[model samples]
Target: MTGLRKSPRRLRIGSERGSASVEVAVIAPALIALLGLMIAFGRVTDADAAVDAAAHAAARAASLERDATGAQARARAAAEDSLHGDGVTCQSTDVVVDTSSYMLDVGQAATVTATISCTARLSDIALPGLPGAKTLTATFTSPIDTYRGRQ
Candidate 1:
């Protein structure tokens, strides 16, 4: 006698065949888009850090000057130099220096502020209604020595 009666056969892989490939095909575009976004974000973050460093260098350079005219020139040059050294190429770069503190009376606390704006080109990251470039701005302030003689 047979130990057990025969049971109805069930097919486990009949309908689900190639489902993994289908799922991957459906999700491939989304995954690619996510990766692209991450790469773009990383580039923007690096540019932001470079711009901040440029601003800081500009502020420091301007703070060492004794006159507003020299400070402005130095700040602009320093900002450009720093950005270039950091391998950040900007399509358009602007440097602004606030020299109001330079006019303060001697022995008073003085501060110089430098603001840098940079528009960097993106790598084929074009979207509808979105520009292919990103503008990053940074501002830094540095204290001028109170004991230093002013012009």
Candidate 2:
């Protein structure tokens, strides 16, 4: 033997197979988490818009009459209709009407508040990072001054 050096041989732990599964395992969780976040954000955005619209509408209605109770109900309905979306379960929506002396008096301002709550349903899947679902709430407020065509 003339001073020869041996090179290390390459070893195959298994087959060229399990790599795909390993890659999927690593990426699936992140993908699921991202999807969940997107859905939650979308729901929150919708709720916020609905609440704002309801508040504004309620205030306008309240300003028209001496009593704000009826205005509150109409505003709630409008808010619900605004927030209607596909595959969304809406609940726990509250509309609050605050007025001076429980009535809208001429030259008196009243505050209208609208709250919208919603949840996105996400069933457990391959990724454990994503929980069952998520809940979100949004609120809006506006003030309107009572007006009577003339003194």
Candidate 3:
């Protein structure tokens, strides 16, 4: 008994052997969640940027020749290039060009919509718990009438 009492520190240390795991269990999830959210948000922002770039490109193209198909195509290419140059898929089969305003109108902006998905990986344990991945869509509008070209 005396020896055991003398080694009280050792016993205390031994009791907490799995305590690291406990601490990790409590904290790891929150950390993982934060990280996942950040990654997801990053992808969302990137997608938005791509859409904006696509819209800008399309509007510029439309302003030149009033060709809706070409404008949409340019926008899609630009957006795809934004995402590692993998090529973007336009959300709609038809690239709607609101030529109603024409170049003479104050607001001759056209809308382009695209969807992009990104894969984010986490710890193996967290993978099943977290959403596998998310597909994000973004719409961009640019004013064709306001386009001056070559600033």
Candidate 4:
């Protein structure tokens, strides 16, 4: 029985010391980068929604006017107001209104289209592979009342 004694296993504790810290140090940067990308994507999506809303507002405002000149002016104002109210800051903005529907006679079907372009800021995030600014454009069309008179 004395010759059949088993040897004890080694703990190997020293060899594994600081391994967790090394793993954390190696993985931390990747995790941070992923989080930054998610935030940037969210911001872009929100900006797109804002631009779309602005376009819709512009088209609706234009459709309410009876003259081409009035439609253009009202559409631009509505788009600017919508963007400002939504808290979307733009480096530059452009609003285009299509008021050809105003030429249609009363009782005819017509539509007004509005396009809004906005440059949204993303440089503040400081994420690699992301553009400093992204231009987002949205277009919307609204139908004019068929029975309404147009100039």
Candidate 5:
């Protein structure tokens, strides 16, 4: 009767020694860059969503106004407030409201369009060839009350 003996598996350390180190050295920077890119895109996406919300709020505010001048003012204020409330700090923010439909006669379909444009600062994200800021824009339209009278 012979006893079974277990042998250890040999590791080929001659050619593969330090291979993992080399791989890390080669891939670390690329992985880091990819992470940075994803973060930048996420920031842009957040800013885009914020802009869209601001535009919708502005349009709705404008549509509820009685006069074009007041509508424009309300739209601008609503957009700025919405962006700020959402924590979207923009380097520059612009709100453009089209209140031409206010001139339409009563019982006619009227619409208010609001465009929100914002240049969001991206200093936190460090990536080559990527700008320090990105501009996000959104437009929304809201209808005025059909039976509302115009002054």
Candidate 6:
């Protein structure tokens, strides 16, 4: 019995030492990249919503105007104000108002269309392979008062 005494199973402490650190080192970059991607996606989504709202506002503003020139100017201002109020900072912003409806005679059904384009900056995210900026565009149409006079 003494001669057959079982040898104790040896635990290899050194083999597992620093393993957690190694694992973290290997996985940290991937986790960081994933988080960055999520942030980028969120930013893009928010910008899209902002642009859409801007277009809607612009179209509504334009539809309320009685003349083509006034409609264009009001639409641009409304779009810009909407985007700014939404905290969307764009590298370049373009607002196009189609006011052909204003030429329609009074009591005729017509609509105004507004298109807004914003170049949102993504470089702040600092994600590799991500575009420095993305252009978000939205278009909206609003019906003008059928009984209202138009020029």
The local distance difference test score of each candidate is 0.89, 0.56, 0.49, 0.92, 0.92, 0.94
Task: Name the top lDDT candidate.
Answer: 6
Query: Which runs in model 4 stand beyond 4 Å of their true positions?
Result: 1-11
lDDT of 4: 0.92
Q: Candidate 1 at 58: error in angstroms?
A: 0.5
Clashes of each: 0, 0, 0, 0, 0, 0
Query: If both were scored by TM-score, which would come out higher, candidate 5 or candidate 6?
Result: 6
Which one is best on TM-score?
6
lDDT of 6 at 125: 93
**Cα lDDT of model 4 by residue, 1-151, tens digit:** 9557544433366568899999999999899899999988888899899999999999999999988999999999999999999999999999999998888889889999999999999999987888999999999999999998788
Find the 10 residues in a row with the least total lDDT in model 6. 6-15
Q: lDDT of model 2 at residue 126?
A: 32
Better of 1 and 5 by lDDT: 5
Which residue pairs clash within candidate 2? none
Pitting candidate 1 against candidate 2, the one with the higher TM-score is 1
Query: How do all models score by TM-score?
Result: 0.81, 0.57, 0.53, 0.88, 0.87, 0.92
Distance from true location, Cα of 112 in model 6, Å: 0.3
For residues 1-151, what per-residue lDDT tens digits would candidate 6 score against the true structure? 8667644543466457899999999999999999999999999999999999999999999999989999999999999999999999999999999998888889888999999999999999998999999999999999999998888
Looking at model 4, which ten-residue stretch has the lowest summed lDDT? 5-14
Give the Cα-based TM-score of candidate 3 against the true structure.
Answer: 0.53
Alpha-carbon runs more than 4 Å astray in model 2: 1-18, 85-88, 101-151
- Which tens-of-lDDT digit does each residue in 67-146 have in candidate 3? 45555466545544554442434333223344333424334343323333333223333444556444444344454545
**lDDT string, candidate 5, 1-151, tens digits:** 2345433332445558899999999999999999999999888999999999999999999999999999999999999999999999999999999999999999999999999999998887878888999888999999999998765
